[model samples]
Target: MFGFGIVGLLRTIFRSRSLLWSLAVYELRGRYAATLAGSVWAIVNPLVLIGVFWFVTAYGLKVTFEDGPPYFLMVFCGIVPWIAFSEALSGGTNSVLGAAYLVKKIAFPMEVLPLVPIVSTVIVHAVLIVFLLFIMAVNGLPPQLHYIQILYFSGAMLTFAAALSFVLAPVNVFQRDTAHVIGAILTIWFWVTPVIWPVDNLPDWAYAIIRMNPLFYIVQGYRGVLLYDQPFWFQWPLDLWFWACTLFVLLLGSLLFGRLKPHFADVL
Candidate 1:
């Protein structure tokens, strides 16, 4: 039964790929539809935030890495993935509720709804990555072969985000508060994920606990590739743990979403 569910889910997603892409494009445009800056805000917002953190940590707090890239680069690598994930999570959590009209349509494949935001964020993420590479080159840190691992790491992040969205979207249909709760959780989640600070400052035990955060693997992976030039396999243990956690979440989300799907229209 479980095998069948997984297979069926994959088939559904594959069949709905066109619809998913269309919706994602629509969502991306809708995000900045009326705004003057439109899509430019995607790059501008993160840059502004990164500038603030760089100033505070580099100047005010006197934070520095003994044998690492500049502070801002570290923060940039870490926050890029974070911004993508957080946006995907927040948007995905409300995907179903926001598309109530689609949910009511019996012919629609609701699984794709959660994926819309993720796909939309991926477009923005690609743009940020290009900007990141440009910055790296300007700072004399030219791109290297190890940067290819970005594809692997990004695929992992997308899978993790999609798994989570599957769980959150259905719940939000029944409990409107789920979206607000997710926002609160993400705020705390961000601070703890080492986006602005180095994990080396933490005690061994604290590092262990923080490593358990699935996002830690992704943020660190981005840094490893862009800054450290370390391959994904360099941290095999964390890689295994991340995949294990992601698979578990994927299974749980599939189960929860499947169980809850039947009632989504009714609830909405």
Candidate 2:
């Protein structure tokens, strides 16, 4: 049953690949079409937020890291992936509802709805990564071969986000509050995930609990590759745990979305 579910899900996406890319591109352009700044906001928005956080933490709170790279770079590595995930999850959660007209069309593959935002966000994320590398170079931390692991971590992050969207997007169709709840949850999740803070400051017990957060793996993996040049394999246990959780969510989301998909047209 699970195998069929996985196969069916992959087949649906594979068959819709071209349509998916078109929709993703349309969505990306439509977002900033009216603004004067247009697509530039995609890169600017995250940088502005990062700048504010850096100033507040580094100046207001006097937060400093003595043992590693500069605090701004550390925060940037963590924040970049996080912003991408947060945007993907938020946009994917609303994807089905936002395209209500398409949902009413019988031939359309609704499964691609939630994936649209992820594809669009990846474009912006790629740009942000380049900016991050430039910042690192300016700060005297040249890029290394270990940076190649970013591809692996990025795939992991997108997979996890897509799994979550698969679950939340269908649920949001039935209950609009799901979107608001996600916003609140993301705000809280950000604080707990150690994006702006160092994991070393946490006690062993707290660190153990924090390690369970799937996002903790992504954030730490980003830091490991960008700052420490640590290979993804160095943290085998966490890597194992992250994939296990992600697969469970992916399977559950696939089944849940399949069960609920038939009703989406009715509800929307």
Candidate 3:
């Protein structure tokens, strides 16, 4: 069943590449198509958050930190991936809900809908990282050759998020409450993962608990490569763990979605 589902997903994707691409591009552009500032919102929002936090933490409250370029840079470093994870998960979670009309009316491969959110947001995320790179350079932190590892880290993140979305999209169709639970869980997750503060901010016992969260590795890997200019030595173990988890999630989600897919045409 798993093998057949994998084949189905691939065949659907290959056959609907044009459909997926068009929907993905349309969704992405529609975000700013009528906006006054256009793509400026993408850069501006991150900059505002970075500036506000940089002031409050570094000066207004005077928090101690271990990373370079001070507090703002650290937060921005973490925010890049956090934002991607947040957008991908949120958009992907609600993807099926918004796509109900299409699912009901069209005879197309349904898997393409879940993928549209992931692809569109991944593009925004890649663009966001470029802005981050510019910020790092402006702050006198030049890029290191080791930064090449970012590609691996980012690819892993994109795959993990897309795979997770497979399950979320299908589940949300069955139970709307999944979306609310997910939003609440992600809210708690943001604080627990050490984005605004260092892991050392917590006591050893508490830090251990925070360390168990998978999103921590995603945030840390980006910071490690882009900000610290270090290879992901301390993080390789976590990376292995995350990739393993991602693969398991993908396989299970595919199987579950496959088993349930025959009902989707009727359910919607």
Q: Assess candidate 2 and give its TM-score to the true structure.
A: 0.97
After superposition on all C-alphas, the RMSD of every candidate to the true structure, in Å, is 1.4, 1.1, 2.3
lDDT digits (tens) for residues 138-181 of candidate 2: 99998888798899999999999999999999999999999999
| CA lDDT, every model vs. true structure | 0.88, 0.92, 0.78
- Worst ten in a row by lDDT for model 2: 57-66
Candidate 3 global TM-score: 0.88
After TM-score superposition, what is the CA distance of residue 224 in candidate 3 from its true location, in Å? 1.3
Worst 10 residues of 1 by lDDT: 1-10
Ranking by TM-score: 2, 1, 3
lDDT of 1 at 11: 84
lDDT of 3 at 192: 83
Q: Count the backbone clashes (under 3 Å) in each candidate.
A: 0, 0, 0
Candidate 1 residue runs with Cα over 4 Å from true position: none
Q: Give residue 3's error in model 2 in angstroms.
A: 1.9
lDDT tens digits by residue: candidate 1, 1-268: 6666666777899999999999999988788889998877766887787678768877898866677788888888998899889999999899999998998997899988999999989988898888888888998899888798898888899889998998899889899999999999999999999998889889999998999999999999989888988888777788899998887777777888889988988888
Looking at model 1, the pairs that clash are none
Q: Which prediction has more favorable lDDT, 1 or 2? A: 2
